[model samples]
Target: MSRGHRLALAILLLTAATAPVGTAPVTANAGDGALVTAVPNPTADGDAGEYAVVRVPTASTANWTLDDGERVVAVPTDRPAARVALTATPNATRRLTDVPVVAVPALALSNAGERLRLRRNGAAAAALTYRDAPEGDRLVRTDDGTAWRPLGYQPRDVHRYGPATVTGFVLPDSPSLPVETLRSARRRLLLAGYTLTSSRVVDALIAAHRRGVAVRVLVDAEPVGGRTARGAAALDRLAAAGVDVRALGGPRARFDYHHPKYAVVDDRALVLTENWKPAGVGGRSSRGWGVVVDSAPVAADLAALFRADAGWRDALPWRRFRRGKTFAPGASAEGSYPSRFEPTETTAAGVRVLTAPGNAESALVGVIDGADDRVDVIQPTVGRRDGPLLRATIRAAERGVRVRILVSGAWYVAEENAALVEWLNGLAERRDLPLTARVAEPAGRYEKIHAKGVVADGVVVVGSLNWNENAVSENREVALAVRSDALAAYFRETFVADWQGRGRVGRTTWVVVAGALAALVLAVVVARKTIRFA
Candidate 1:
């Protein structure tokens, strides 16, 4: 708000107002599908209530005027120039591939509950009315109808994306997974996670909103039932606080459930292998790993996914949950699981992002297959006895690599994981493989290892991708594979600490204990029979 900066912004605004208007390729008017595609309420350079994006459809004329209820806002004339004072991005391809975009520089369309109209030849063609628009959101109309999607995040597809500087960090340590991390958001906050039940986290977000940060959140609709009811209740609390919240998965949802967990604050992308619930990372109730990426491209990539899911208005629909006390229906997927999002390639210098219901399994197997020396893993759930991930670990052990797996020993996670460990140990004994498995004990600061991460050779794969069939092929998940020793070693040290802690019990010791209990029971039964005979 300095004088010099204000003067520069004013100059830019004047340029946009007098800039030559460019002609469109067609003669279609507002009555056609010539609707607005993007309205960047506040451009990166300009303040709010100063700019907007107007989409002039293909085969349409650019000679049109926009109105803000009572008066005219913009009138176009013949001058060969781009429509917008700033460059705008397309929400999609196909019909909107090459649509001419006009960046209106002087429209005061930032206030909520204001009606903005596009008119041609004195006839109103299209209109947009917003209510509590989230911070940094763009109003878009991709189809012919008037339903505009509030796209809060920007899109940067894979091909157009660039390198990312991936930095590794351990959560509940060093920086610790505290609410203060979110409370520090300055400009925009984009959050997409599996579940959010932590009150401190929610309160921090509310505080951020009060401080004028544009905050938006997307969470899985399931878990509204069962033991995870608090997560749904927290969503209600967030909505009541005026935070723009959206639930993924309802009647017309895409996948079985949405399960990706990450957050973008300004240019930083914080990816995690835990949910936003209390037990996941709050106070280190469970062991988890997180990565902080200081790359704009990486942040933009995640922001794009958020935008797609939040703004999905197509036939394969994504429904928004209403703010209420009653639980929303269609939150659960029952037993039917399906694929929704498409997979794309992500390769940077030392990091790669793999999304599930795609090639995440392949990427995971590829990491294990490429291991040359050792493999260390901490997972809450393992796949089937002979699944791809398990088989890869077995193969790694077969090749004389030191393979160690630390699985959850908490009651709920122990049943499924214990059976897998017993089977794997039996197989390892028979095949003389170097694989060793242990179940984490629930006696320390952390009760369970809810993370899905591995240190194979020098590469680290960490995120919300659980080692299960459903996680890889049914639920929507995300993970980061960093092929750097420094990053991998950070996780490796944490793994080593957990391995040596009293919280982990080896497989061989469990077998011996089970045998001793059986012997004790038989001896007691024999003594009772002798006493009865006497």
Candidate 2:
């Protein structure tokens, strides 16, 4: 028999076996066990695509009815103590969830606010009420069934790790740290990132795969500016070498972007604010911060995160995803810089792994709010002026904690960054607060600021969380909060160097300055000759 027919036969047998024999149906009053557990808003054509979940305390729900104030429909399940979905469209609803679905042709849920109740033989067993529903979101009851809230796309929880040794490094200074760490993997390696085009890293992964290391990679299916030919080629190379590579994204993707940068190598975890591109991990352009933690718990937590992200429905194998897809040609970063800071080994008293679309914003804001001495923020850019993070920083400054924000000086954001800095400085001067902001002057150190980092007191935050609402609320970003004075000092030193523009003049900076001066001299000579002729 076909699958559908088999399912029907199974349901019929279950119903016949579980149905109550010849007794009268029991009527339930208030405080009974049946409850409306969840309701999903209509995201498709009409109300038929929506569903309401009911949980019962007994095996059979033959006597239960769902009343939505406007109309009543009988609960259609003989399964006991199970969570079942009552929908007008069973086949479509089954595709969204694993719960048993029963088609109730008379069932219809409104998008606007409504009150629903579970009735047993005409008596109300439990009741649930909700306001207007959010598009594509589900309203679910609490475990105790006392409260209800909208369910978002949060899949991972905020994880914490106890004291352990961490090796911290800054990019363009210790580019070999990540590659060497990857090469040291013995049993397994799980790498996740927004993009991967670094040849050095790819070679290390291939070598690890060849030596029987179970190497797997997960990256964004569609990175900013789309996938590049070099990135696609790198992924193909890894797949050819028996490495498992998958990309995360699709119409039903849980995150706006899978943009975390980290790798799990056996019992060690490497987290960074950089992508897997030449400008980031290869240490050629962008200045970024990273850490390699030597703790089994940390590595295990990161490994779990990788599996959860990669095992989702949206994750597609590299070969399958590349079919009929086109890639754009992109240039690789070739800039080199002097090593101003070396990797440092330190011990954090505690470490917390923060991820986006759930706990990252509040956790990061807590970091700023807990600042007692100073808060130094380094980012490509921040969110709006009145955003939560900025507001928290301002509050910290008000409480006498010095706050300094350094933003990117890249041309694309230079104008707005300058404006924000001026506004912040103006507010500081007017209010007599210890708040300041500045645009980074790459000043020959590296290219522009690409680090999303903060050094507050003795704690340092390093990872790929951009200080914006969308990044914190929608994207799949990861960051680490390491409470170690040594690590904080290392990142603080680099932040100070970039903030003060104290690095030696890079060749490009010198050439630009020289060209401008030469142009000024020519203008002066022309003006003098014109005056003499007149």
Candidate 1 backbone collisions, by pair: 26-59, 83-102, 84-103, 441-503
Worst 10 residues of 2 by lDDT: 10-19
* Model 1 per-residue lDDT tens digits across residues 1-534: 221222223211101121232222122443332334334343233433334445444344645677666767654434353343223222221112233434444444443445555566656555545444333334432222222222322222212234566656554442244355577788878888877877778887888888898899887765535324556667767787888888775433444567888888877777888778665546345667777766777777777777776664311211245434354432321121121111112323566777775567888899999998999988987877678988899899989999988888878777777776777667777788888777776344465677789999878888888887778755668787776676666678778777765543447556776799788779989887533321
Model 1's TM-score against the true structure:
0.60
Q: Which ten residues in a row are the worst by lDDT in model 1?
A: 10-19
lDDT of all predictions: 0.61, 0.79
Choose the strongest candidate by TM-score: 2
Candidate 1, residue 343: the lDDT equals 18
Model 2 C-alpha lDDT per residue in residues 1-534, reported as the tens digit of each score? 221222222210001111243222222432354444445464466744578887765555447788777899987446653678888898878766667888888887766666677776676665655555554556432222222222334345678889999999999888999999999999999999999999999999999999999999999998878999999999999999889999988655667788999999999999999999889999999989999999999999889888888886678999999999889899999999988898999889999999886678788899999999999999998878998889999999999999988898898887777778778877887799998787888878899889999999999999899987668866789999999998888889888888888422333234556899789779989888543321
TM per model?
A: 0.60, 0.82
Q: Pick the candidate with the highest lDDT.
A: 2
- In model 2, what is the error at residue 469, expressed in angstroms? 1.4
